[model samples]
Target: MRLHRGGRLRWPTIGLAAVVGIGVLWHGRAAPALPTAEVKTGELVDFVELRGEVKAVKSVTLNAPSSTDGDLQIISILKNGTGVKTGENVVQLDTVKLQRTREQQQSDLKRAEAEIEGAQAQARLQEEQNRTELMQARYDVERARLDVQKQEILSAIEAGKTKLRLATAEQRAREAEQKLRSGRAAAAADIESKKQKRAKALFEVQRAQRGIESMTLKAPVDGMVTILPNWRGRFFGANAPEFKEGDRVWPGAPLVELPDLSAVRVAARVDEAERGQLSLGQTAVVRVDAVPDKEFTGTVSDISALAKIDFSTWPPPKNFDLALRVAQSDPRLRPGMSATARVAIDRVPGALLIPVAASFQKGGRTVSYVLRGARFEERTIEIARRNREQIAVARGLRAGEKVALRDPTEEASRR
Candidate 1:
């Protein structure tokens, strides 16, 4: 609209004219002579920065199996920190001695069985011989008894001889009966002894066979394999040696581990000062050092109730260990990878905020120098809350307004 002769500019119109006169300052402003920050409303997230490492949620451990052959010598083993799949061979123990023992035991078992069979046959033969001898002794006793009966018709001297022969035959019969009873029991005992030996040999053979079968160890889950430290290794020093080929381990000792990689977590340590800022179920973004291309989103799965002190430094700083359960577990994530986490402790949505440095107490009121057309106007502001870096403003500020970081009057005075 064009101005007419009768038109007059009011106070409000004058104010609008002055603002437009400043080169349309509302759309954009010229470079400020001093540092400044904008008053804007946005979502604010308080984060606790944590430095830690990536690890699996759970791990599968494989220990050296108990060996019956008295040998735990590892013939082959996967290297430490090697990735593996389920059912993959992890360690192969030396089975040569076990195989030899098994073969020897098996041979012994067969020999014992053969000996039992032979002894049983011998017992049966002895039993048959005993029965035949007993029958012959009874027949001899009966013949002698008949001779005694004929003594009544013989002469005196010949009758006495017949009677003596009958007595001798009776004594021999008793001896034969005793021998038959003793021999039968002895044969049965001998057979039983041989059978017991066979049973023992069979048990040994079974145990050796089991030991031979358990020689090769395989991965139980898909993960990274970390060889357990050999405390008795040849190179015993500050650092323990990792299990490898030709290493002799004790029976039932823990030898290797397969960490589960499907569900991964970040183990983080936070300073005690930041402990209160984190809680379970808070969201986090973790970046692994090895996998720099990915940022895995996760939730705070666990928080330590106790604190761990760092003794390497003076007046040790107490820290708490917490775990973050990753929502998207990339296959590339591995245990012990250095990870950094940004845990959102708290979130404020749609809050009007300004830099903490923008406002200061002046004349008993918190005030900031807000940008006016070609000038700075110091205005009193109401602050609802504040964090280390930002202050949430409850009043006296609007979005898109620039506030001076430092007093422009002070800058002019310094100049």
Candidate 2:
């Protein structure tokens, strides 16, 4: 029943209209539209991508081989980017001081030679004089012995004065013997001292020769000559420029570097999140940004067992570095070229896969929508494997099923 409007029997008419309106409202409410998806079988793959750099297989910063004794002067850079053969002179240090040292050493050596000669002559002369003196002393002793013998004979004849004279003669003979022994010993000591002086002089000469040879720097291997720069614009051998044209350098300064560029390998950093999927001998596709059209193929040659921390700044950033070997190297590929690398982690052969966005969670399991006539229905599906872009459907889905592509929020608004 309904309230009467302004005419006879309006109550019955109003009640009938009310019942019809309720029926229309109830029938017009449609089921909420649900998003749907289809099941399909396809291949899936997992990959880890990282930014890398193209580098020489062997590259090193040449350090001065000698210690920093003084300001090193670059005499001359033999060849820049010039291919030098092994044993070739890459750099020439200033040999002024070296030359002066050599001259001084030569002078010292000459002086030593003269001294040795003088010592030898003196030793020979002294030995001859000692021999003469020894002979003379022996002659004198013999004469004295004869005299003592004569005196003794006279003393034996019973003359008191003759006995005293014989005693004095015996004393004089003993003194001559002592003088001869002392002269011989002094001569032997002088010869030994002279020999030692000669040995010391010879050692100094050898040392000087070695120092001179060190001034000339030679290439250790056949490679390109890269002149390393010092704080000043001059490029010298490793360590510091220890010599000028005339400056003498001490031993062991790094003066040159010979780098072999037969092959190139890239040392790249891979994030820890992707480290688990990476392994040795995996194929890598590298693209050098400098040479965009050229693609280089490589394999994972090595992986760092431990993570490296960058302590240069506060709170270190951690990363796992790896080395990728270019199977085929091009001459144009140089060190420090920016590159991109793709490392394949896993691949599925002809498996059912779908866009990751199409899959949603329902009751702790992945689910998707399946279009049913004019509406959509939610169907729970099992995910065997997944990546950021796609997921492999394991079960609860079939091929040719249509799924909604609209945003879930839009679908809810429609409801």
Candidate 3:
């Protein structure tokens, strides 16, 4: 080795020593081990996921028979899950009071009919009496005229008296004619009043008959009988008792449901944020919570135009209801079954994609931390599109490149 004067190191050798010192400082602390994922070239799908329940495409709900007043107590009902045929008896109400009312009305109807007949007979008799009086009055008038004619041929004193007698007979005929007219008018009015009363009684009888018929409810179609909740029965819980024997049901209240199991669909609610993405005929994959292994294909059949408030919380979130038609129906698919659906809205094939968490922002530019050897190199990446869980890289990334899931500087400092 060559030495400089007075045992000092050579200038070139001193520069080399300084370089070694910097290298030692760079390797002093190890780089932090970070969670990483490789950028992959594959198809990327953006989908909206919704949670909901299975329902029937066609469902028939049977409401309580309409009543004028008070509630209808259930006397007997079919079993909750019993299969029923069309025109079969499904429910029977307590008709004891209705029966009593019907009997009373029937008696009233008979009395009304008897009154009508009696009134008709009296009207006929009154008509005959009036006709006889009218005829007698005409005869009296003719006899008075004959007496006046005789006055012209008799003696003077007798002729004067005969004229006076004719005058009195004519007066009596006028009074009889007035009586006949008044009697006929009074009898007709009395008959009309009685007929009106009879009509009222007949209406009551018919109404009572209809009420008795409404007490017995029958199945309108063939399907399984599913009992509906009695909303009035409970006061302090989300669930209410089902309609059964001895239960009091109100008018227009749902009593039972008949769901057509041949056609099934899922009824789900989409988040308000994703409401705009839903459209008719969009396809989806549905998975039932009860049957996890199978995935059913479905298409969107209906979507609500307006949002509804979710009442489960204070300041509730808005939600939109949607119906998905299942492509195929299975026997295991029953109404009220819980299910989840994933609806694909957009897709990209053979794209460079990475986990969304592996990307970060710096200096108003999108970036990703790449693991290179013992350290992480920060690279700026251009984003093409993104979803809830993944992001598609448009530039500055290639397939098989490793990206750090978190900030490398922060993790390294902790280490």
Candidate 4:
């Protein structure tokens, strides 16, 4: 059926050659290569990796002094990272208002004292006047009695007059005695009331003085001062400012943090999936993101029982706060530094493990592809456990067995 070339009848031969070339082209296409891994027996470490921040194991938070009067205004604060000594002044609130209050209280106290003095003087003057009147009354009574005795020698009318005069004198003397007693009682009561007022004024003055002292916060322990975030009724975000002069801080608001540099730790949040994998006293390898070159060893010390949710977002993610005590302290490890912790939960001294990619789920069973004579054969394997990088095989696979990392059937389909 081919066209003839040159001489003779060559059509049949040309047709045969064309058929052979097509056969060769069909047989020469390359087969796709399948990537594989060899199962190995080695130490398998099951660890939970967490991203966290460096923190002080021991930290003292300095909160703004509790004030009955509104938010306290910061007047002076030690700069962040400043090393401080014990009892050193670290923060100071605006004492202008407190000082004014103290002054007023003192003035009130002075007034109270003056009132007390006036009350005492008035009492003394009353006592003297009462005494003089009482004496005059007694003298009059005695004169009246002497006149009455002389009346016995006079006429009956004179006697009667003298008797009336004596009776009036005696009545006047009794009235004077009553007035003196009443005056003393009134004076004592007045003086006591003034004393009570003075005591109250003194209390107010003392309270004001204590408030002034509270305005100046002193460092309880010696350490570097780190200013805390000023919430200021705003959402926490990157670039939040710290407490500074002129900032109004609410009562009990954290103004500064003095971190004990000698003791350090890492605080990390664990995902719900890894919650059961972490336990107290678990060893971990910690690496600071800022100081990557330096690695620290730590032990899990604490874990929150309740999950923390950020309500600001819808469908918030649950995070559990956990702390790991650093085995050794480093000068470069500072609070707020981002870090990563690889907590070793379970360890197998020797186990047959393979890359997770080497296994696939088939018929609800773990299966691997084993190469046999240039063909991949699907082999069912029992998986004991799986980690991030590898899976531990319990049965159906042996150490040193070569298996396809990816399904070879996919390669065949592509080819």
The number of the candidate with the highest lDDT is 4
lDDT of 3 by residue, 1-415 (tens): 7665965656778899999999987865455777899999987889898989888899998877666478888898998778899989888888888888878888887887788789778878877887787777778778767877886688889878777777777777787778777877877787777778778878888888788777777888998887877777765535567888999888767888889988889998887889888799888989998888789999999999999987545577899989999887787776777898998898899889999999998989999988777777899999998888899999988888899999987776675
Cα-lDDT of candidate 1: 0.83
Model 4: lDDT to the true structure:
0.87
- Reference-based TM-score of each model: 0.62, 0.58, 0.68, 0.76
TM-score, candidate 2, is 0.58
RMSD over all Cα atoms, model 1: 9.8
Task: List model 2 lDDT by residue over 1-415, tens digit each.
Answer: 5555576677678999999999887556553454445667787877778787766677543444363246445566564467787777766665566566667766766776676677667766766766665566566556655655665456555455455555655565556556556755765666566556656666766666665565557777677765432333234332332223433333454444455567877778876788888999998788888778788888899999999984434566688989988877776665656788887788887778777887777669777776665456677888889876778888866778776555443566765
Clashing pairs in 1: none
Candidate 3 lDDT score at position 339:
96
Clashing pairs in 3: none
Residue pairs in candidate 4 whose N, alpha carbon or C atoms collide under 3 angstroms: none
Runs in model 2 deviating more than 4 A are: 1-45, 51-63, 66-73, 78-80, 93-108, 145-212, 226-257, 271-277, 309-316, 351-415
Model 3, global lDDT: 0.84
* lDDT per residue as tens, model 4, 1-415: 5555663556677889999999877555543477788999987788999888888988999887776578888989999889999999999988888889999999999999999999999999999999999999999999999999898598999999889999999998999999999999999999999999999999999999999898888999989988887766456433456778999888888889899989899988887888988899999999998887888999999999999985444577797999999998878777878899999998886789999999998879889988765567789999887788888898988888889988866777776
Whole-model Cα lDDT per candidate?
0.83, 0.66, 0.84, 0.87
Model 1 vs. true fold: TM: 0.62
Tens-digit lDDT string for candidate 1 (246-281): 888888878887887878888888888899888999
Worst lDDT run of 10 residues, candidate 4, spans 231-240
lDDT of 1 at 79: 79
